[model samples]
Target: MTGWLDVHAHYLTDRYTQACTAAGHHHPDGMPALPAWNPQDALAFMDAAGIAASVLSVSSPGVHFGDDSLGADRAARDLARHVNDFGADLVTSHRSRFGLAASLPLPDIQGALRELDHAYGDLRADAIALKTNYHGRYLSDPAFSPVLTALDAHAAVVTLHPTSPPGWQRTALDRPRPMIEFLFDTTRCVIDLALSGTLARYPRVRWIVPHAGAVLPTLAHRVAFVCDLTGTPADLPTALGNLHYDLAGTPLPVALETLLKLAPPNRLLYGSDYPFTPAPAALQLATALRQSPHLQDATLDLTPDSPGATLFPRLFAQQGRPEDRASPA
Candidate 1:
């Protein structure tokens, strides 16, 4: 009933639908218009579930398509603004109950930089959301350094969500993408970043990898060995330590153990990947977290000082209740 924050979610807008159609991409099964996916619906769900805040973000398959870098960049940038403005309006209406994560045009450094400036200066987004891989190239690639560089300059808090690689959807496996591929994508991204020294280069950037860091925790020993073989022992712990993991869509025992072994307690935050994954699941996970014997004495309580205290402690105190705030973040 308290310390609840749903940080991962998707809302479809006209700009996003149009971009999908323009790029010859078929809209997914659940894709719909803005009104159909409004924050009001999320608020209603949160209220019913006893959630205090929900940090919303545009969903995956973010703008990049097969070699359509320029077109994807333009679409992504425009859609980022549209989403941010819409989120700003929602925050104005709902205040602390809702915040936004900005979408970026990845693999296109300049476009990403421009979007970052606009999203921060104008839209006042709480953080940024990025897919693990854009079209097959992982963000850990050196080619994407400029994107990280721009994010570091802005001191952005980024949440890494995952989507299947292009052409892999509806495969013969007959499995929901989230059940199998999303976790793999997240783990792969973490490994790529570790191998590429991304964590070292952009040390200050705060990242939250969803699904409790996917498979990274379970496979850390092997990953560490690989790093050692490659003569980068320092990167193993650095990557494991520097990143945050969101407790969205991951089982409690798995998430709790992963947090315990791979990251600090404070780096483990609450997140419910809503809509696609229901809010009740998060409640169940939180209950399990509270009951975990593996957790230390420090992490037993996840509640904020006030309803909105965890994410925006100072702002909530200064501005009074969350509904009274003017800015989106």
Candidate 2:
């Protein structure tokens, strides 16, 4: 049980892959083609990387795949249901090794509400996964108030993943969106949520921001200054401090150092981002975390009583591995 608990892994069902293919979104957000995914392969990768368990979710370009209004919403609803059902099955089959962050069809409030109820009530999802922006609408927009209200009422855990920002394709940048724009979009969404008062209004919904808050460390002071100048009631620093972060891609000296400055050690969680991040890369990062001098004195907490444990207590409770359950605080 000497392994990490990965909070940011991804799972792609066969039907989900097909839906992406049909929508011409195989290389979603202009990244490389979707990687092959199977439960056995995922479990093997986790074992090889010393990952005790992984909380999975659908990744970028999510369920809303079409351009036509009616068609896209309908497709998103169906795909969300399919993906959730598949994820629920995985959780049931591999209770100790897997957890789920149910997907919702955003920008379609009614559809999202329906799926939320089904995911929380029927599937018993551990958390919810939301893109930084739904279509062209940011999460702070009033359009998502209903969804936010529901999640707030339940005191749910929400993980924010980056999507291709609007007009990203026209940027003329040679690199893929994930390389640069994904981080920017993630930053944008955080700022938007803070400025629009979503964080204040929905205090009970625990948030997990991936990729080490996606450049938030570098921009924290600047954002705080802007908030001051704008007369915004929200304090960017406080808002950011309250959220949990996942060490997904590369949690080395730079990323790790920056994150420590903004968040306490308990607020940090390990994330593999597997399938999207190949096993070798994920293993390398995990090894790096273990060897990092900065973490030498700190015990990596990944238990039900850890700082963000309330997000998915059931998943952590199923962690029968003694070492995992005994993770240092």
Candidate 3:
């Protein structure tokens, strides 16, 4: 694990920033202004952190930046394409060091489907990054079933990122949404999928749950009990075990222990939530992960050559493009 394969790094393009700024989405989900990001700065941080490769996706406040149905949907679609194209170019320039998890303009199934085709068929994205909720609609809603079906057809790897829940954004108790709301929203999305039978319906879609499964691990048994009482056939523990959890911002000992109880070592992946997390903080978490006593013999696959590679074969397989082994920055 000399060089990490970060599954949770973010890439912010200039076009994306402009879109957010113009839409007055500066404090998205109640977080402060968007963190600055540039290829050189990201590459420099990766070098210092010993990250050989990173799978990039857009951060919070995704593409849909406003409430206008017609206008915002169109803007979101365009922004999604721009972000994907920008990420694809980064992967092209640094084939071995960069991979893309294409963003989708959710709450708009047709537009998302179009982007999905372009991302996989045209740009060759490694995975799809989906927000927990879209305009107050959770991913498990029937409206998103079409997109889930399409993803299932491709057997796509989908990464779940948290966004402010519809009505809770303004009521975060004056604290940053990521501090508490993000974790709660992640749990909400997972529970919705489980209760609504979405997870059981689409088993092929490999889900990557960030922030160590984000409070879901702690509530797995309770959810299972409730499901049993309600006669829902969803198996909470098994559903969680089927998915991957990244050790990103929440890399504490308790978080690791709880997540491991649900997902095995093979299902664990490395993540550095860079830019959102400063370089020093990201490095601190990485060091803590390496030194964890529970993970002493866990075979944490942070590098490209690990069981984690099987999680996204289209991107990690050594068959297509020539590997770009050049120094980053």
Per-residue CA lDDT of model 2 for 115-155, tens digit only, reads 99999999999999999997788998887999999999989
lDDT of 3 by residue, 172-262 (tens): 8878889999999999998888778898899889999999999998899898988788887557888788788888987686898988888
Scored against the true structure, residue 225 in model 3 reaches a CA lDDT of 89
What lDDT is obtained when candidate 3 is compared to the true structure?
Answer: 0.84
TM-score, predicted candidate 2 vs. hidden true structure:
0.93
Kindly give the number of clashing pairs for every candidate: 0, 0, 0
Candidate 1: give the clashing pairs.
Answer: none
Writing each residue's lDDT as its tens digit, candidate 1 over 1-329 gives 34355666566667666776676655442234222465667777776655666778876766554365566567666766676677667767766577778887776777778888877898777788888888878888788888888788877778888877545655516555666778787888888787777877887677888887788878877878876788877547556866767777764645667556777666666666776565566557656665677644333222544223444442343333537545444
lDDT for 137 in candidate 2 is 88
Candidate 1 residue 114 Cα shift, in angstroms, is 1.1
**How much is 45 displaced in model 1, in angstroms?**
1.8
Over 4 Å off, model 2: 230-234, 297-301, 321-329
Query: Candidate 1: where are CA atoms >4 Å away?
Result: 14-36, 166-174, 279-322, 325-329
Clash tally for model 3: 0
Candidate 3 versus truth, CA RMSD in Å, comes to 2.8
